[model samples]
Target: MITAENLTKRYGKTLAVDALSFSAPRGAITAFLGPNGAGKSTTMRMVMGLDRPSRGSALIDGKRVQDLPAVPRTVGAMLEMGNHQPRMSARAYLGWQAHSARLPRTRVSEVLELTGLASAARRQVGSFSLGMRQRLGIASALLGDPENLILDEPINGLDPQGVLWVRSLLTHLAAQGRTIFISSHLLAEVEAVADRIVVIGRGRLITECSMAELRERAGTRATIVSTPDAKKLVRVLREDGAQVESELSAQEVVRVFDRSASQVGEMAAEHSLRLHGLLQEKVTLEQAFMELTAGAVEFRDGGQEPSATAVPSAMSDGDPQ
Candidate 1:
């Protein structure tokens, strides 16, 4: 497991990471999410001891990562594993990692097979596709067969098939009791794999909670059902401090935004109204996460909202085409 407390980091005049604290539990996939320039990279670097924190501490297995003996044996990190030597073959490159880390030679081929790169093991690193490069990075990370995995944007350039492959692999690793702490801006994908979310915005912790808890805090949406009596119900609900909206169906779906479902249920009973349908909309982890980070994102400075147009493009494909 990884634990960070009041983790702070700074550069010259810029505070990169600000007082972040969270526990990445074992036997679970913990997702780290943030907007651009939210200090994700810096925090990861600090955890790996590639960078020092100006304040606070990040611990792995109950000890500071830097203090661990042979950290590579306990923590496997796949950060920006984009570096490559054009002339070096994939096999040779991975072999070098084994040599440097004193990892067993047999483990290299195992990771290659696990990442589906055994077929291209002889090819030069520079000739590998972007997807292949990501696999290679993952291979190196698993080389030590560490108990912890820290992957930053593991699906960044993956095609749909590659994305699914990565997801399954991470899930399997966590199932075997490894602590998987992955960072990604992809909400829907993270929702599937992550058991918990640690969100940061503008270099600070927004909230850390399980997927279900976050949605509960955000409140499930209620579809207001109405007819001509909808107007009366809407007014009554409004007077009761409930939020109501008119629907395109010529019906007003009463949404008790902050009200509990039980409260709404009780209110609906008291009205003695014959309702068509009273539905509570399910709030996905993505929506709840977006709401929490909405105002604090570093991407917006003038308070301008992001275009809804970008959401679709950012979504992972429904299936591999």
Candidate 2:
């Protein structure tokens, strides 16, 4: 297991990471999510021992990555792909790293095939497209086939096919009992692939929860009703302990927020109310995220709007595709 105990990182006066703590256990995909400049990259860098933390520390098993018996063979990571050499082929680069790590040299070819880079193995990494470079970087991370995979935005530059391939590969690795820790801005993508999520904002841990637990805890299953007698319906629903809001352009058509569609249906039937429309509406990931991170936001409570015509309501984390 990879665990962090009060992990904190400071750069001069700015604390890039606060006292955050979480774990990535074997046999699970733990998603790390945050906004831009939210200290996600900094935390990952600290975990990989690329930068020493000003306070606190991260460890794999019982030892820090810096104190591990073997460095690259214990943890494999793909942070950014811009550090590739200009003249080296993907195969050559990966093979060289694998050999240096004393891993089976044949594992290089395996990683190339696994990342779907076999066709581009002989191409110079510098001449490759952003998507190809991303794949090659992932290939290098998997060269040693380490027990842990810490990928930051692993799908940053990829075609639909490549994205699917990476998703499948990660899911498969997690099923094999390898710890898969990933950081991403795409909530819906992680919803499909990850078993647990560790959400942070402004350099602090917001919530660490399983997908099902988050859905149950944060997401509200609401019943949306549109009726001609909006005011009357709202009055009736409100009498039944359901939260009603304003959503009418004309006379009396109201939107009610109830815990369940069945509850609304039962109340409507009891009151003998004629409903024009009633349906269940799920609170999406972005909506839940907005609620989850409301307190963590810096300028939201302040009187500054990013724009005059910007969206008044928050955005939900869904339907990124």
Give the winner by TM-score: 2
Worst lDDT 10-window in candidate 1: 312-321
Error of 2 at 303 (Å): 12
lDDT by residue for model 2 over 1-321, one digit each (tens)?
A: 789889987665566678989998999999988665567777887898887887897988768987887767778998765888869998888878887888888898898888888988898888999888888888888877788989988888788888898899999999998899998777777777889889887678999988888888865656677766666777887776878885666644555655577777777778788777777776666677777777555444468753332112221211010
TM-score for all models, in order of appearance: 0.80, 0.82
Q: Candidate 1 regions off by >4 Å?
A: 224-279, 301-321
Candidate 1 CA-lDDT value = 0.79
lDDT (C-alpha) at residue 99 in model 1: 97
Candidate with best lDDT: 1
Residue 124's C-alpha lDDT in candidate 1? 97
Provide the lDDT at 29 for model 2: 95
Model 2, residue 129: distance off in Å is 1.6
250-306 per-residue lDDT for model 1 (tens digits)? 654555565655665667668865556666677887778778778655445688765
